[model samples]
Target: MPLSDIVRALNAPATGKRPDFLYRSGLDHPFVAAEGRVFIHYANIRLESKFLPVVDTRSGRTHGHASTIQAFGLSNSVPMSPDAVFVLPTDAEEFVYLDRLVRTLHALNYLTQPVRGNLLLRVHSRHIISVPANHGLAFEEILRPCGLLPEQITLEINTDAVADKEHFIRAVASYRSRGYGIAISHFGRTELDFPFLSQLRPDIVKLDNLLLASGRPLDRIIDNIHELGGRILIEGIDSANLRRNASSLAIDLVQAHAPILRPSGIRIRRNADGGEQLDAAA
Candidate 1:
């Protein structure tokens, strides 16, 4: 259901019952939840298979699909309207896996979707600097296989624990030159240096949700970036209530625990035993 429909139903006269929503995840629900507010009613309620659903707050639909592979089919990780995902090399030894993961994400057949959304794959600053200069994809190289343009796929780098600033800037600039969209992750908490932001000129600034959720206003800084035409993404939206609050903000995007997309319409989830089963909803 569209947000406008919900608004209409909310204001409409006392009808027999309320309107239900068919989520992009294929799950049918009564209504969208708000924090401590009215439980907007919906007519049909059916128990469909449940997964981490990503809800695009901007549009009432799923924009991207993701799974919490690390959480044993129990992920609350949401991939919202804009795509963003956290990637980190466990150690120097796991760099291969990280690289492979990036390559695999780029090669996904679903990337061929006509209106390809942001397929964000995040990584730490150390990994950004560590990418063997010759091995990492050039700007167009990143777009070639995926068929997603430079702007579609975001190379999110968390600066929270950068070990080396000079190397980090170099790596970021290298990617920038190549046309890969740059995302500076954990904006409010780490670095918080205006000059660094000015120099880096990140394509996206992902703010820390902890502070946003705490209700501590970072409006002064956030507004400054907005003025400069920087896109803001709010993460750490872990619950329904949190999402309501996020909607109130002017952030460009959001990451939540809700199910966003069910990639390629395949619902075979990885079980704890390391086996895949067809989701009942499927």
Candidate 2:
């Protein structure tokens, strides 16, 4: 089936129910394709999906690609940060809607690439809190129609962003049972939650580089995460020395790009084992 057809079906409204936000305004579809790539038209901006490479430290191969969205003004082509883009949503419903919409955008764009391995994506904390139950259900539905498997996506949630521990744990379990990989981001940014970590047993733990700078007990934390069967991923290795030191710490994966604000024009030099090398700018 054509991608557009699948998107239409996904966006189609149920009987007697109002159309979802994506199909509202009588627009045929909120997505547009250009240069054989997909982009979403959202909130007067054009959002495009960009993947950040997650490299395996041992063999120096790309382990996976984390999906991130790059937004640009529809009229002026000015770039906008993800934070700025997300701030457009006003209420809980809108927050959930926009969160799912951006993930859908990433999923569609990922399908166009010849990349392999899991696609890691960050789920808005607000989106998780807004949904009372059935977390990951709605996004899983969208993924299925896009010809993507739940097992191929890792839903990442920042540690500091989550407010309700119980709901967050439940949501992570929901994603896990549905076959999506779970990644706990910014693990050491705030106070460590060992009990919560034990309960979740996330597939990946993305460490905040601040732990290293602050002279915290990173080795013990890494050990605990490993005991819980979580792979450690240290992001924000901007300097060569930092990258070298991070590799020596037995980190499973390392991302050299900035975690919070990723750069544009990420050129993939070579593709190996679902991992791609980033340009110097990335």
Candidate 3:
């Protein structure tokens, strides 16, 4: 669909109240990409003040008019839009957090997409129990109407959480049954049993940036993973060198934060003179 059509669809009237857990006060400027994606980030804060008197132990002098001020900030920030949204799960407060995330995205006119792409959500294994047994079913009901396929959305499970084989297997099974893609993140850092991972057969495996940065022999690992029928995604690529190296290794996907910030929309081409040309799109 055209971008204008998507914008119009997003602006249409909503039928119900917004989710209660949504941090409406801290909603940031919505960033819309040419691909029709939207992103929003927010922060939550709590402040407290207490009055107290202080005394100097060495000088034996008492002082008054002293006060203590403390501010605790807990951010539940995420990028939301029709094409894609990224969420991080830090606490076991699954229902409230997920409810707010889904409702916020739904309200932002993203749910109107006939075929939304990936909705990447980062979740820990410990909090998996907080998710309902039939959570995948609920997600299917919520996202399928928006034209999102189970494979299009991925739940990024942190490696730390996957140490428990039972929980990991169960969660993987549940999501896979509903057709959602399961990706194991922080691949190299974790001491995971490769044979066990082969058994689980995850759809995607994200290699840690540190391994790539170290200039290690990643090609062998990538080839092995591909042979096992899993696609490899290299994350935390920051420089052109890293991208070049990743491409050399035949990595399937390379994701970086910096490149998106200053998007030139430039398509590189090889000129007839055997030189590279940058063609900036309008």
Candidate 4:
């Protein structure tokens, strides 16, 4: 069936009284029934311009004016809104660039106001050049003035980047002090020590795709995290089977990007084990 037909069918009233438009599109990204409500992923790019006679690597020559471009496919998500879309960066440098871009976009009136929900930005460990401790403070400075609520915005940090117990705790504490939500992305990727993670008490924890793909027993893990007062988001779920499995585990959230365009509709039901399920309707 065509994409429009699939969306139309999914939105039909028969698919349960509650909202039926929730569907997975490309990977683990969720999308509403309407296209306008979907979020887009963007990468950061840097352009350098210098007025000097310098050798060009590509042209193998010198010139009075030269420009260099550096770009990385750092993943970030931004929801569509009347105002300018606020994007979160994957690293400190990207965050810097994003801060400038957001200001420019806002000043130019290219983005409409009032702004929507706070954008969640990812921070990679490699982005910290020296004082990793200052990263959270820097992020708060960049976002607080943008009219984003502390709880509405989240800073996503990979578990690997926070290898140091003391540093991780401090960083999380600093952000929490600023009223910003701290999230640990890609949780359960490795057997890293999580004693501090539980202690620091981040608001969100994104479960690793590995665990979702493995189809392992996750009830205990989910229950434990919930008990610790952390919201869990499961990623990389691409099939009904995986969705069923995740729902059975009672994962707080499941991201699916595939099968949305398919004929099947989003099914929010319960598995035989009495756990929640998110998959295409049979």
Candidate with best lDDT: 2
Model 1 segments more than 4 A misplaced? 1-97, 106-109, 112-115, 132-143, 236-248, 258-282
What are the per-residue Cα lDDT tens digits for candidate 3 across 1-282? 444444334333242222223323333222232334433232342222222222222332332112122223334222122112213344556434544343334323334444334445545454465664654665564443345566656666765435566666776788888887777777777454577677667767778766656667777888878887877775543445645555566666644321111134454544323355566532
Candidate 1's error at 34, in angstroms? 38
Q: For model 2, where is the 10-residue window of minimal lDDT?
A: 15-24
* The best candidate in terms of TM-score: 2
Model 4 quality (TM-score): 0.50
Pairwise TM-score winner, candidates 1 and 4: 1
* TM-scores vs. true structure, each candidate: 0.55, 0.85, 0.55, 0.50
- List runs of model 3 lying over 4 Å from the truth: 1-96, 99-119, 258-282
- Candidate 1, residue 239: Cα displacement in angstroms equals 5.2
After best superposition, candidate 3 residue 252: deviation in angstroms? 1.0
Q: In what order do the candidates fall by TM-score, top score first?
A: 2, 1, 3, 4
Model with the higher TM-score, candidate 2 or 3? 2
Off by over 4 Å in 2: 2-28, 258-282
List clashing residue pairs in candidate 1: 19-42, 52-259, 53-258, 53-259, 53-260, 54-258, 54-259, 54-260, 139-178
Worst 10 residues of 4 by lDDT: 45-54
Candidate 3: 10-residue stretch with minimal lDDT: 77-86
- Cα deviation at 46, candidate 2, in Å, is 1.0
Query: Candidates' lDDT values, in order?
Result: 0.48, 0.76, 0.48, 0.44
